[model samples]
Target: LAIAHQYVTQGGLDYAREILESALGPRKAKEILEKVQQTIRTTGFNLLENVDPKQIVNFIQKEHPQTIALLLAHMEPKNAAPIVSALPQELQVDVATRIATMESISPETLDQVEEVLVSQIKSLFGGDVSEIGGVKAVAEMLNSVDRGAEKNILGNLERENPELATEIKNLMFVFEDVLLLDDRSMQRVLKEIDTKDLSMALKGASEELQEKFFRNMSSRAAEMIREDMEFMGPIRLKDVEEVQQRIVDVIRRLEEDGEIIISGRGGDEDIVV
Candidate 1:
């Protein structure tokens, strides 16, 4: 056990697990193996996370979307988003769609992706076959990407697979994410959105989010929107959601156009002067 633990600490998790199984029996080995496996996975994630995204982009650019999706599914969203954004635009959509619809990746497929990474990245992938790449994965990755890449990918995805696109979009930055925008960005977004749409959208929002928008506006304008929302009274959930989506679309468009910056969500960190 001491020798195996040494091997594990040195990143020889598979070898250590095998040694443990042989010496300690499967039942006892399993407990140790599980811990070893978790360590291996964390090591694998950190190894990839530490790599330059451009190196990864150049290495995998020519690979099939399914291959790209499978590899990215193993990475943390922050690490994966830039690679997706750097991919050729068409591949971006294809990979995003594949990731949204993907359920599980076979061990063989994982090994193949690992082989590609090992050749170019000098990194190892160590983990069991597991569920990965569903709508949430795609959403999280997209959330971390620039609005332009995110919009282009989702736009193409909408035409190719509407239902999957809607599902992924639903999981992504919702109306509530507006609260994440800085005051300057919030004011810029408000300029693009109609007051009625904003009122309707805020109807379903939390008080905090409503106040976020209100504080960014003039006192008169903020009070007017509040009055508009109250007069509208008891709007349908579906209607509120629709208007919220429209407002969210406007925010996405403005960001894509470089009119505003949404910081701390991922992607490039902007230093505002």
Candidate 2:
């Protein structure tokens, strides 16, 4: 029963229940299954979620945009984001547009896509498909991707589908978008950031962004940050990006907690008060 319950939580509910029914009578298995269902929230079963994003990217890169969109739409945004980022810039925009504008995919279509995915990744097991994709999903996926890819995709998307692009852009908040915060919100965000991370993150920041943070800090503290960055010398772009992402995550968390407000851009209406 414990093992079966574990399987249920790990996205093998049907297989778990089937084995339980064989080991125990239908009545016993049914009772156990019912209890597990009531106690645990399943994210539905998706073997694709466990596969490495790089492997998925290699297999799907040559596929049609719509086919790639269908697979990514079914995946968790975190997993899907990297795969999208890894694609060629042109394909990235094509797939993102498909995901944003995508509607419900018929089960027949899903089955066909699923077969292709499973056959390519052979180790992937069958699992249930739930509804996914649209502007919100695209936004979430874009939010996880690197700034360069995000900008490139959105730029192309803006030309291809202006309305849809605006909707997606409205939902996203990139690392550089921290500049959208007011002085009060920026200070609040700064208080939560580590000095080391701030220095590293600012290494790759634009002059305008550096000034935004500097203006919020005491003159002495801002000078110290500049000294640290100057002494650090050449740093890997990947390391800089990682630290910037962490700082952006802090900003998003503070915003979610209502401790800060990110002002609107991309023609969003300004706050009245």
Q: How well is each residue in 43-62 modelled by candidate 1, as lDDT tens digits?
A: 67467778789988987887
Identify the leading candidate in terms of lDDT. Answer: 1
Residues 1-273 of candidate 2 have per-residue lDDT tens digits of 567779786767788788888999899998888667533422222567787878878888988999888778877888888898899999999999989988765545655665666665654322233455899999988877766687799889888889998788666777789788999998898899999999999999999999999999999999999999999999999999889878877886786565777664221233456
TM-score of each: 0.68, 0.51
Angstrom error at residue 221, model 1: 6.2
lDDT measured at residue 7 in model 1 versus the true structure, 0 to 100: 71
- Candidate 2, superposed: residue stretches over 4 Å from native: 1-45, 123-130, 174-273
- Global lDDT of each model? 0.80, 0.79
lDDT, candidate 2, residue 91? Answer: 96
Q: Residue-pair clashes per candidate, as listed?
A: 0, 0
